[model samples]
Target: MFRRICLQLHWLIGISAGLVLAIMGLSGGMYSFSSELIQLIDPQITRVSPSNAAALSPAILLEKISQHSPYVSSLSLSDDPEQAARVGFMTPQADSGAKKFEQQYLNPYTAELLGKPASEDFFRVVLNLHRKLALDQGGKALTGAATLALLLLIISGMYLRWPTTKSLNWRSWLYLDWRLSGRDFLSRLHVVLATIAMLAYLVFALTSLSWSYEWYRKGLNALLGNDSATISKTANASRAASNQSPSKALDLAAVWTSFRTEVPHYQKLILLLPSGSASTVQILYLDKQAAHPYANNRMVFDAASGVLQTHERYADKSPSAKLMASLYALHSGSFFGSAGMLIMMLVALLMPVLAVTGWTMYLSRRR
Candidate 1:
């Protein structure tokens, strides 16, 4: 009786939430390769011809950028000379809703503006569709609920597909019987493909829940022994301290020098410039030889005096801290490596297939 109830709930959820999950999955699959896609699609704007001379200092680059545009938020510099330096800005929209993020590339060697990458806007739309269905706050809540439903669907589907002791075998669970036609083929395909993609979907649902639900995020941080409140308080205190004095022009070259002195070798680095009254410049960088793509080392430097205030190396972090820091990488499957991301993308692409098959079977049953 309980199993029957579980089966019914699974069907109901699959029909109700399946479409949303499919959309999310499709968007996610596309976004997983966003960086590569952007570079490929807009190489002229995104890439640069390498020069033998050193790239312009951050100060000089910022000065040149400021001449064309104001309110620069962050600057990303890559050790790969072929990559253009990206400068980011957050501008308020006319509707006064969410701020729009704009990014422009600069020739690191010459400090010449290299108009925005065309693919950036496309991916931004894809990301918004995945996260919020492009409907803003209402969409966020719907996606969160759909994610919860997906978690339930995965669990119940696994339970329903569990084999008895005598029937337990790799072939029984994993093999797809293609000889069957119509409903039989779909049923086999749905269960077998879902079983194959189960772990990846679980990772997607679990990691994505943090973005959708505040309670889930807080609970996760708690589980990981992260004190979010304390971190918030510390940040507030830093901002408050910075607010005490009027904002002044920053000597970015000295701060960049201080950063280089602290960490001599890096693959790529992003300098988060201070905003408003804040005078603390934050630098996040990956070492030349790092554990993974997301293994970021952070340093906080005083914008005024160019003195290094604090440095936090990814290697020095505790296991939980490391896990917390790696949530994005884990979600994207880049934490496992390139092969993991490929697997993740494949699984994500399978969501629409699963949904279509499941719906077809359901309609056939009703008929």
Candidate 2:
């Protein structure tokens, strides 16, 4: 009776979330290589041809950029001589809703504006579609529910599909019988593929929790000893609370040298100018040698003094923090390295196939 109940519940949940999961999977597969794809589709918005001379001093580049355009929100630096740095302009307070900045690619060597990046808008749309069908909060809620449902579906399906014969019929459980056709073939494919894809689905669900639930995110950080509020407090204290006045304008040359001494071979380093007296000048860098994207790490520097304030090294993170950070990579299948990403992409592409086949089998049964 209990097994029967689980089987029904699994079917019920799968029916409810199947379409949503399918959409998520399709969109996710597309976005898994978003950074690379965007660049490939349009290199002007992302890459830069390297120059013989060293790139301009950070401060000089900012001054030149400001002269060329009104915005000066933040900028990125790359070690690759061929890649241009990126700069963003702060949106006027009046230009409201879901954005406060627009990005422009810049040639760091000459401080010349390349062009306004367009791929950002495309990804934003994909994000909306993936997160909530572009419905904002309502969409987020729906997707959150779908994520939970999919998780339950996985659990129930596994229970119902558990092997019972000698050695649990390893061959039957692991591989589809090629001899079957039509609904039998589709059903076997759905079951076997879903089983194979369960780990990726679980990773997607757990990682997605942070995007959908504030409480879950806070709880996760706290559990992982990375309470954001506590970190903020520590950051404030480190900002030198006694000195309320803003520090002098930073010399980027000195800062760059300092940063290089720390991370000598970063792929790209994003340096955000301080926004307020209490703010830290932020640095986000991905080491060129890192095996995956999760190695992109963050550092905070004293706004006035340009001294290293705090560093969040990927290697030093706690297990939970490490897990949380790995969520993005896991979702894209980069967690297992390049080969894993390929597997991840395949799973995403197969989601819609599974959904369609499963639903077809369901309808056939009802008939």
Backbone clashes in model 1, listed as residue pairs: none
Q: What's the CA RMSD for each of the models?
A: 2.8, 3.9
Which regions of candidate 1 fall more than 4 Å away from where they truly are? Answer: 91-100, 231-247
Cα-lDDT of candidate 1: 0.86
Look at candidate 2 and give me any clashing residue pairs. Answer: 48-82
| Candidate 1 C-alpha lDDT tens digits along 1-367 | 9999999999999999999999999999999989999999999999999988999989899888887766577789998879999987665567875556667888999989899877899999999999999999999999999999989999999999998576689987888887899999999999999999998888888888887877887798799898878655654654443223223658888998998888877899888777666878888899987777899887888888889988889999889778877878888989988888898998999999999999999999999
Off by over 4 Å in 2: 95-99, 117-120, 222-228, 231-250
Model 2, position 158, has a per-residue lDDT of 80
- Compared with the true structure, model 1 gives a TM-score of 0.94
lDDT of each: 0.86, 0.75
Lowest-sum lDDT 10-residue window in model 2: 238-247
